[model samples]
Target: MAKGVISAADQAEQLKQDGNTYFKKNRLGAAIDAYTEAITLCPNIPVYWTNRALCHLKRNDWTRVEEDCLKAVQLDNKSVKGHYMLGLALLQKEKYAEGIKELQRALDLGRGAHPNSYMVEEIWQELATAKYQEWERDSTKRSWELRRLKESCETALEEKYSRDDVSQKTDDTDEISNSTSEQLAALKLVFDKAAEADTPTDVPDYLCCKITLDIFRDPVITPSGLTYERAVILDHLEKVGKFDPITRETLFASQLIPNLAIKEAVEAFLEKHGWAYKMD
Candidate 1:
């Protein structure tokens, strides 16, 4: 409370503001410098570290981005930006699983804290893109595995039938026929197990959008706290006028917020129960 002396927090805030100005002008180096200075002054502030991480992200410096965001998250475990940046960094390094996990965490946190904020949508989109990429990779791997299995099965059957025993050839043919049936049954079991793992149970009604009656991909909340698919609601607003479909209360597109919590919950449910690429 000194008359002329400025507190460290105040000085750091000024530096952060300066950083924002530099960032807007595309002066990434200068923005990073300002943010670094702010961090030096107030090392405990997670935003300063996240701001610096943003500059590193622009420069494609994944290592530095990971380092800064890790520090940010260490300081504030609930930090959405920290988790988001860390996810991007890991993705750049080709750490798909870890990166996707961090993105999901960011989506969860951002949704819980600011359900209607742009950050929540951004996180959801990024998570969706990452999951798609993962699905592509898994699809390719599965195809290759299936081909290999088919080749192996053919080779085994061929070897069994090529036995050199003329004395018992007829008996051998009968036995081999039964063996082939058993092998086919085993192959069918393998595919059946895979299908069983991927098959989802009946979806809950609350999780489905009112318009589409399907599980939500991009759920948004009206002012009345009712959730619907973003695309369906926008279409409804344009065609049916501004009103809640169920309640018939006044509603506006501007008043809708991305229902991130529901999105997160749906994603978690799908991860455990649904087939790959089903959500997409």
Candidate 2:
């Protein structure tokens, strides 16, 4: 209560931490604002400049990032992070010679200070490989560079989602597979029932159509109060005459309604004696 005013160093440090928090949350604009405020409060902090450069890098503002990273290096020539970010920015802008120089410098510093840093990631290895591959063919080198671009994108995605709870990922693959299997089983059952109705046995006279003299694939009724297979009845109406073959009564093919009950009985019979269908 007595000392309400914050010290400049403490305030700047707090702002820098706020920027880090915002950056972690992917609020790049807010993070940049916080880092800029921190830099204004404490211009000598090279890390603050480097942190702001990282936010700009996220936005793909390579020019702005290059400027910030260059300033960070000017303040602290030994800043490995500053050189790394500057190298990435220049590389993104296709300034390969300058970018490679800065990256090699960062790699050299990283080897001395921290051997297991971002410089050891696949991106660096791929670039190094691509630089050498360039001697063989320009197209092959471009392909490697394209892979590097994709590698950077994947790295950014990893950074964003690395903290997410992977355990909560709802996998519906089993459910979909089971559902498809069940549907196919149901379809097979229907086909089996239809085929079983054709079993070898003395079928009931009513179940057999007079035209084909066999069980119906699709049974239909006529205006003359007789049922027959649809194809047989239609053939008789079109080829023979528009009259019932057995009853000799005038009938129309358009009068056919599905004999669903008969069809079900036939299907049940065929299901029981599928061998009879082979005999037919």
Candidate 3:
């Protein structure tokens, strides 16, 4: 009986070798069949499962790859190839967190003999990129939601005041007014604190344009080169904190402000007001 067992093991080993040859020759289906036969012959061999997993991966049979890889790992806990293949299979299925953990484990195991070493590294990079972008998108969405909520609260408070004055109001109105006032005051305090927080040195040009546009209209010049509206000078003052004639010319030349269309519209409006304005 022992002799028969040894002979069976030898046959399984020979089958596995033939499967590997078929795999190397790019005969994936033949290789898979051979590997399956070997596994049936000697179900205890981790190598048979691992090789079969590779064949499944080549065939894009992700579910089979995972099954075989899990079996390989269960049979041999230290099988780095099994862990790595499992990671790949999970990543292909978009199970990012689990795949990341498994890939990290495979890397820790430090076994580079697996065929998917480069693929594993590439997947790690992709995972990191995707995670960062997702985080950024979520953060932006949260910020917008918070801003909307704040605006809604402020509008509701204003509408309540518009409906009735607190001094002559009923008890329910008084209580609501008090609560709204408290909430608004708290929100204002938080907004103030956020404004006082440390921020980036480089303020966006669009923000500057928006703030400046609120304070001043674009300048208008007569056809005889006499200026009517001092809008350009005011814009320069808002942007640079102090107006400098040289800087104004430089800003126009560089087109640093992105809303040139708005500026042109302002010029047209000025022209309609009997002043011919040259934006440049």
Give the alpha carbon lDDT tens digit for every residue of 1-280 in model 2: 2588888788999999999999999999999999999999999999999999989989999999999999999999989888888988887776776876887777777757764355544334534533433223444454466556655654554453433324334465455445545655665565456433332357677778877787655688877667887766777889999888888888886788888888888767644543232223
Cα lDDT of model 1 by residue, 134-174, tens digit: 76666667667776886688677657666633445776777
Give the clash count for model 3: 0
Using TM-score as the yardstick, the better of models 1 and 2 is 1
- List candidate 2 stretches off by more than 4 Å: 126-280
Q: Which stretches of candidate 1 lie over 4 Å from their true place?
A: 1-3, 164-227, 230-241, 245-269, 272-275, 278-280
Write candidate 3's Cα lDDT for 152-249 as tens digits: 87898778775766554675776667877897899888865653322212222332233233212323332233232244444554676452444333
Q: Quick one: best TM-score, which candidate?
A: 1
**In model 2, where is the ten-residue run with the lowest total lDDT?**
271-280
TM-score of 3: 0.48
Error of 2 at 228 (Å): 83
Screening candidate 1 with a backbone cut-off below 3 angstroms (N, C-alpha, C), the clashing residue pairs are none
How high is each candidate's TM-score? 0.72, 0.46, 0.48
Worst 10 residues of 3 by lDDT: 271-280
